[model samples]
Target: MKRSFGLAFALFVCTFTFAQQALWGGTSIVSPEIHENNTVTFRLKAPKAVKVQVTGDFLPTQKIKTPFGDFDGPGAADLIEKDGTWEYTTPQPLKPELYSYTFLVDGLKMNDPNNVYMIRDVVSVTNVFIIGGGRADLYKVNKVPHGTVSRVWYNSPTLGMDRRLTVYTPAGYETSGKNYPVFYLLHGMGGDEEAWIALGRTAQILDNLIAQGKAKPMIVVMTNGNASQEAAPGESSLGFVSPNMQLPKTMEGSFEMAFPDVVKFIDKNYRTIKRKQARAIAGLSMGGFHSMHISKQFPDMFNYVGLFSAAIMPDNNVKSPVYADLEGKLKAQFAQNPALYWIAIGKTDFLYKANEDFRKLMDDKGYKYMYYETDEGHIWKNWRIYLTEFSPLLFK
Candidate 1:
């Protein structure tokens, strides 16, 4: 009887493991199948569900009224049911870019059963796919000499915390036996050390650009600009914490004051050039604000400065040395004659006016800078474009 029972249990486990149905109550069907023409087909095999809809960025989106602000709410389309499968294909070929979507089974949002690639931004998670050919190709992994990404810990004397950072060293840095320039890349508000690697595809872009000789092989240091957080959610001793936009100590001069500590840690540990000429700093949104202030406050520390859709000024009530002496610091920064001071913003960005005013200040002071204007608003897509365009101009 014991042997018979054991055999039955083994059969049960095998049946559960090797099933034709998806683990989530549906027949397995391939999703996000990209064609040579860049058109995409999404499928769901949920016959039990009354309705299934697909919502993605590839579809048209509208600005919906919200308490916080106006947010892009992409329209959803019902999938046609053929036999047991619910399927939908794009009306037109999708552009070469990363697209995300999810199946709304009877109003319940869920990821694709067949597609495993997903990305989590702050809290929301969605399945993602890439149609490669153009700029999206840079966001995809190519057959090239890749870089090394390390989640390193460093002590921050300014913030009085042990901070975690993501560092990307070039393909041959370990055995190259040569020092290289370092680019300090900062993320936007609500982003952590993992932002650029996941959202911006920094490693893949750096590897491809360096292989094509478009960008210099350098170390990219991505730091957690959120001063209060020790690391990303679930990454530190804090355990799992829900990410929120309400963060303190941001742009309060604490990060700028302790900025040297990050530099010191990198210089001491990495094989960096260790000089003003070989150093560069850039960030998007909040990080852009930090980069602008940090580079100006420490004028001689960085040779390249980029501000992508930066918040040029802080709230009136907040006080800090980092925001003070704006004209004086600009003069001092330009007096040093840095290699590249790039300011890029999208035409539709909410910060476009602020950047325009900042540009006027630069013009009024005769502060030379390379300005780039793009289409779209203050979003990750624009920031990624700014990164690819900005990095090649560094360490030249």
Candidate 2:
């Protein structure tokens, strides 16, 4: 009788283990069977699938015409039907960030009903996946001690309008009485303060970096790149201007005048080390253009200027005679208290050459700057990595 009872107990344990499924918002769903290399493998029990395709915006939206094979290690996707079920894999190893994907069935876009992790993009949902890699680590949201992201509304006397900015305070900020340096980090076109909060993952990235002793603890301020009042969020008729250096075209609101006022407001509200050496400004793409513009415009404001894949090629309008030639301005900016100027770009980025060209201009002008290049392109993957590489060196 005792032996029989033990056998029944063991059977019950096995049943529970086999019946377990990944829970999504409380309901059990398909759990991806992840491989050692972090490749996800799953089988959809759709026996009647005429044709199945896994679609992701990560790669070019062009449909994957053939079965995903070993294009790279543990990378590739395959669509095979066996025993009334369809199985698919990725065509190449995914980047080390969360990817939004959907399965295309007969021209219909559908999410994997079995996958637990999903987010709504408009009316449809996309399945999310995390690729494995050290550079893309910030994309994966983990439950670490997070920093504070606050949306600040201020009266911008400089721009003559009430402007908004996003500020990220690192952990231990609340209790730590010691003030920290400020890093004025800006975003590119089609982005605002929320860009760094979301796509850049600045808070999480900084959290992990500071925790891992890889980066210094500092406050990050993300501001709107557009200088026009019409460019605020949805105020403009043209949704987002992708123009290169036609900068002041979007700078209609006199962002140049209002910028110093924003700095004053930051000094008032935040416990910042309000000195030149304690202040740094940097940006990407359009933001990079602004950083170059603003840092030169207000030579005494910042001690460091970082241009991540900057699009700075002295434009025709802002040419030598117009807004003060590049050489004289850079000289004055670096003359009194030139901060550490750091620039980085991806090897495949469209802005790669632009960055190099800007570097040459800086060299020709005798401006000191640092240049870094990576393997990725003009995407979030490269920007996040750039943040990791650039942040630690600030406020040193």
Candidate 3:
């Protein structure tokens, strides 16, 4: 009886060990398999899931001319399950670009566990993959000199708190011992300092451009423009607040009032060109609004100003007392004789009319500015393109 019991226990141990190995070994299964033809295959091992679907920007709507007419809609197809695994493949080749995707398993959205490359945009998180070559190659880490990105904290007297900002120093910054021009890059509403680096691919773009001798080497500073918050969502001392709460009125002017403090801190801490000619400020959407107000308030602070899909308000629609004298302030700002006041927007953007009216205002005031129009609406695709074009024109 003792011999039989001992033999039984040994068999049990072996069975348990094999089961554990098999369970964990399945984790190596690759879900997103990028093919040489630029087509991608996504797989998910959710045997018990009732439904599964994959969606991404790469599955943009296509026009299909049916017997009745043409219909434009999503091209992505649902994943079919087989042998306890759901799989999907793109019907056609995708363009070379960074794309974000998510999987829906039985109506529950989830990230691709197999793909470790992920990014957060505002409230949503998604897995990402890159199709190499072409313009997307510019967004990839190439065999060129790279820049160092750092998250730096500084005191903000205007907001009466310490804040965090993302700074990108060029590759040779430590050894160059030369003062580099600075670019104050801001993100749209619902975005923070990380937006430019994550979604905009600023570091990769700068590295490629500088290496190609297309853009001048400069420091890019990305700041959190949400004034009520001391830092990005998770980093804020006030803690995470729901999206519905009304921000304090003081938050509206906090960044504008603290603009000087930011400049002073940068100049004192980093090796930067102290003159306005060596400085540039640009942003997208709400950030564009801040840039406009910041440059208007401190006319001599930045020589090159860019507004990408800017949220420009009409004179009467201006609510903040800080911009009460918009026209007069802008007139005075232009009088400072800055080098470039560039505005860019997509034709399909909802703010197109607003930008048009703002451009008309600039025209009426005889303020020299550059205007650029593109093909998309208010999206990150256009914003990235705008940055690619805008950065080359800066510090020239």
Worst 10 residues of 1 by lDDT: 19-28
Q: Candidate 3 lDDT, tens digit per residue, 226-258? A: 776677777777677543223343236667778
RMSD of 3: 5.7
User: Which candidate do you rate higher for lDDT, 2 or 3?
Assistant: 3
lDDT of each: 0.89, 0.69, 0.85
TM-score of 2: 0.74
Q: Can you give the lDDT of residue 362 in candidate 2?
A: 74
| Candidate 2 regions with alpha-carbon error over 4 angstroms | 1-33, 42-52, 57-86, 91-95, 98-128, 138-144, 228-253, 313-324
The lDDT ranking, best first, is 1, 3, 2
Q: Please give each candidate's TM-score.
A: 0.92, 0.74, 0.87
lDDT of 3 at 96: 85
Tens-place lDDT per residue, model 2, 1-396, is: 999999999999887666663222334334355566666665666677787766664555222222311111111244677886677655465556656667766666677777857754213456766675676675555666677888888776656666678899988899998788899998876566667776677888888888777777888998876665433444345665443323344333245455787788889988999988899998887678778878888888998888887767544544332245667887788787675888888776666766777778778867777888887566565677788888888877
| lDDT of residue 56 for candidate 2 | 60
Q: List CA RMSD, all candidates.
A: 3.1, 8.3, 5.7
